[model samples]
Target: FEALHAAVAGLPVSGSRVLPGLVLRRDFAAYCPASGELAAVVVTESLHPALSAPGVEFVVGSEGQYQASLRWCTRRTEAVMKRLQSSNVKLLLSSVKQQEVVIYYAKLYGVSVVECLSSEEIALICEITGVSPCTPFGDNGEITETAVATFCQPLLLGSKRYVHVGFTSVCAFQPHCLILCGPVDGVNEQHAAALQGAFTMLQQLFKTVDQ
Candidate 1:
């Protein structure tokens, strides 16, 4: 990861821009079953500060104070809920993983989440989509709409735990290809050397095409 970050930092940009003009997020996975239905949810407004804040606590000396605080919290939650319900957004807030949350929101909001991505992956996606990646959260992070194309196929290697997941945003021109190999065990030296050779050849091919 450090090497990847350094490589991205070393990329040349114009006008004193040191960092590459790309958005790269790690440990963010948004995937849904291909056979499942997709729904659209547009968030027309930003969330309230009270609801968006990190933590909530109330110091109350009496029942009335406690009740008031509880009421306030309820009202805030209901406000957000009403907005989503009216907008036809599906809300999943119970014991859900981060990846699940991203998937749900993406499905509701008509967007796609690029997961387990490296810097190179990010650059490729941006080149394909012709749009900068949006942050999942923040002032500029709110996305209006995004389209994604997902491709999934089982390796059928007799291991259910190993699956290849990948996607790309819709674009006008042809996009680059990136395939990430999963971890394997009990590989001989010959196979390792062959794999390395294949990887190097692919890299050279990409460089040639780019040039």
Candidate 2:
């Protein structure tokens, strides 16, 4: 459990931490297998088709330009997925939403996807996993680095849904998550505050022990 410094982004990621172990509450995983596990995960921004942008400014009589651009974007996504497949990467994570075409190609390549992540979450992930937040995105985009995980699956905590993941890192701390179950937001917030105070006390206790 190294790097649990002051900036230890508690992140309520129901999110990312740079420590060896991380607590991630993923939005959702697509095309996840029955085992709910992925060998490696790559986090990136968006996977939208570049050709489909509204700002492309079509010609006065341009008939099939839009359709052609869409096709091109889709094809590029396919190529990117192919590269991932060849690299044995089984999971893709996106900080932003993914387009349908990107999802389709991912699934076709036998890769799973977790999308709609916040920037902080993405930063934590990159920090902990030692993976850069770069992937095949733009016309010149072409990085597909990955972080290995022991397990990746959906977790049901009360009525809310979360994703539980086991990351492999150099740190000795195995990250753990604590979920406060309360009917209302106010109660949960109170619980969070109490927990934070408790953790602070524990940290002090640990320092005393170290001394």
lDDT of 2 by residue, 29-119 (tens): 5755635434565555566546435667645346577667667777777888887788777778777778888788887888878887667
Cα-based lDDT for every prediction: 0.37, 0.63
Per model, how many backbone clashes are there? 1, 2
lDDT of 1 by residue, 91-161 (tens): 22111123343355445543333344445544554455454543323454334433233443232222222
TM-score between candidate 1 and the true structure:
0.36
Best by TM-score: 2
- Give the Å error, residue 72, model 1: 9.1
RMSD (CA, Å), each prediction: 12.0, 6.4
Off by over 4 Å in 1: 1-131, 136-142, 150-157, 162-193, 198-211
Candidate number of the best lDDT: 2
Clashes of 2: 2
In candidate 2 the C-alpha lDDT for residue 87 amounts to: 74
